[model samples]
Target: MQIKDRINAFINLGKFLSEIDTESNPILNKAEAENGWFTQDNINFALNSWAKALSEENIKQWLSNYNLETTAQRSKIVAIIMAGNVPLVGFHDFLSVLITGNKALVKLSSNDKTLLPYLANHLISIEPKFKNLIEFTEGRLQNFDAVIATGSNNTARYFDYYFGKYPNIIRKNRNSVAVLTGNETEDELTKLANDIFRYFGLGCRNVSKIYIPENYNFEAFFKAMFSWKEIINNNKYINNYDYNKAVYLMDSFPLLDNEFMLLKEDNGFSSPISVVFYEKYTSLESLKKNLKESELHIQCIVSKAGIPNEVPFGKAQNPELWDYADGVDTVDFLLKLP
Candidate 1:
């Protein structure tokens, strides 16, 4: 299929996604049945984000930013090993391989087995040409010329050892962080809460940790976070909160609790569900040095602190098409595939 046709197919798929209502949509019901983690709210959020990203104007603007005219027109089969952390987490990589005039051999994660295939069927129904361009595998992946895999640090090593022979983009564990100046408005902090609570903090783009000025008061932060107090109503989340809090208390670790989530002073980037890690920074310059030293572990930064390339507060989940994971350009990697 031609590039324009592929783009149009995705745009139509986005329109279809926008119309899905979990209460009434059979597709969504099937997906939820297949994976209990794929809650209705989370599935709808993923669809809305994808719809916005796949709009005609957005797609054109994103493609315009790249020079695809010189890309070699040969076709290659690109294997995609998707992560099931969040709904449709691997769709972007799937779209990239197909949009760049390559075939996709996708291996779906067991935790997320239903949604993407349903969308793929929709794409083929929109334009039958897609039938030849997309395929899913349940067994060993073979006959693929290149690969794109997403997993934890341990699984990434296996991908490196096996797929290292092929052109590949293998992503390991990474988490997002926010730098707070302790002067943000309640509105901004409210938005930051969305970044944290959305998807139940499973996405890499979720703000798992925050950096605040030393001696920062917790009153305003706790008040702003109260907007999401309803999250405790979720049984799964409450279980995590209860378990993690008990573990911290047993160890006599200092914690800030609001009955819904726990906050602890930790220097790490990845935080457990229903918990957020925080660190105190003395100066912006020193924080910059620390961030630079651990850039690889960070997926994105949410801040209004004038930090370079920092994603604005509350917009971490709404990544643009160019916001490649692990700072690796998937499109450029596909374009250069030999």
Candidate 2:
């Protein structure tokens, strides 16, 4: 199919998914009953991003960034081993593969097995030519023209060993951050709260931690965030938070708290499960050095400064159209490969 035809198909698909009962599907429904997960909202988030990615200006810009042609000239085969920290975590990779006119062999995560199949069906329905391009499988993948794999730190080593030997882009576990200059507006803090709390803070894109100016006032941050206390009070999220809080407190670990804040210093690349950690930075210079020292562990960057210039910050879980993990344009490269 033509580029315009494919792009229109995805836009139409988004309009369709906006109203469907995501929980009606067995794969998606399980996450909801089991964890009170908001699958529909997660699906909607991806669909929104899909629509954005398909926009003519945005698509053209993204392709130009990747040094890719927009006339759908490539026809390579791509095997995408998608990570599923949250629902539709693999959607970006799928979009990259589809829009670039490559065969995509996608392997879905057990945690989020529903949305991929549903979207795959929808794509085929929208552009039947894509019917031959998208396939969901659990089987061993080929060396293929290119392979894009996203997984944990441990599993990433395995992906590196196997796929690294080939023309592949294998992503390891990465985290986002929020840099607080102590000048953040309430609305900015509120948006940061969404970055932290959405998807119950399960996605790697979730801002698992923060970097604030040393001795900055967190009182304002808490005041702004707790305004959406209903989200903080969510059972799914509170369970993770409370459980981690109890463990840290029981261990006699020191932390600051009011009703909605957890403040502490951590040495690990990430905090314990369900907990958000913070480290102090005296200046942006030191922050840059810290990121340089921690380069292998960082992911997307979020800030009020439009697109990020550093490795990562506050926009941990919600990635925009161009925010591929590991700072690589794996999809565009895959499709462009000769």
Candidate 3:
């Protein structure tokens, strides 16, 4: 298929996603049945986000940055090992491989097995040529020119051991964080709540940690987090919260609790569900340097502190089409494949 044909097919798929009625969507029910974490609201959020991103204008503009006309001649097959932490997490890789006029051999995450294939079928119905461009495997992956895999740091080691000889983009675990100046507006804090509670904090883009000015008061932060108090009603989240809280209490660790989420002073980036880690910062300059040193471990930064490439508070989940994960350009990687 030509580049134009591929783009047009995705544009139509976006329109289909935009028109889905969550209240009446059967696929969503089946997804939730397979994975309890795939709640209706979160699944629709992922669908709608992709819908907005796949617009003709957005896709065209994003593609303008690259030369894709030459990509068709290579016709490579890319192996994609998707992560199932959040709904449709691997859709970006799937879209990249196909839109660049390359074939995709996909291995669906067991946690997110149903959604992408269903969408792939929709794409095929829109453009039958896509039937030749996409394949899903339940067994060993073979006959692939390159690989794109996402997993935890441990699994990433396994991917490296196996796929190291090929051209690849093997991603390891990374977390997002926020730098708070302690002067954020109520609206900004409310928006930050979405970044925190959305998908129950499973996404890499979620703010798992925050840097607060020393002596920062917790009153406003707690009040702002109240907006997501309803998240406590989720059984899995509450169970985690209860268990983690008990463990912390047994260890006599200091904790700030608001009955819904726990806040602990920690230097770590990855926080458990229903908990957000926080650290006190004395100097912005020093903190920026520290963050710069740890860039590889961070997916994105949410801040108004003027750090380079910082994502504004509450906008972490709404990544643009160009926000490549792990600071690696997937399109450029594909286009350069020999």
Task: Give, for candidate 3, the lowest lDDT window spanning 10 residues.
Answer: 20-29
- List model 1 lDDT by residue over 179-203, tens digit each: 9998999999999999898988999
In model 2, the runs with Cα more than 4 Å from the true position are 18-39, 64-74, 232-234, 304-318
Local distance difference test scores for all models: 0.90, 0.70, 0.94
User: Cα lDDT of model 2 overall?
Assistant: 0.70
* lDDT-superior candidate, 2 or 3: 3
In what order do the candidates fall by lDDT, top score first? 3, 1, 2
Of 2 and 3, which scores higher on TM-score? Answer: 3
TM-score of each: 0.97, 0.86, 0.99
Candidate 2: the clashing residue pairs are 177-313, 177-314, 178-314, 205-316, 205-317, 206-316, 206-317, 300-312, 301-312, 301-313
Top TM-score model: 3
lDDT of 2 by residue, 1-338 (tens): 67667666776776666555554666566654543565456655655555555556665566565544443665777888888777777787888887777788888777667667877887788788888888888788864777888888899899888877667778777877666778778787877887876766667767777787778888888886675567555666667668778888999999876555466677555665456788887778767777777767776556653333643334455455676777787555765576
Candidate 1 stretches with Cα past 4 Å from truth are 69-72
TM-score-best of 1 and 3: 3
Output the TM-score of candidate 2: 0.86
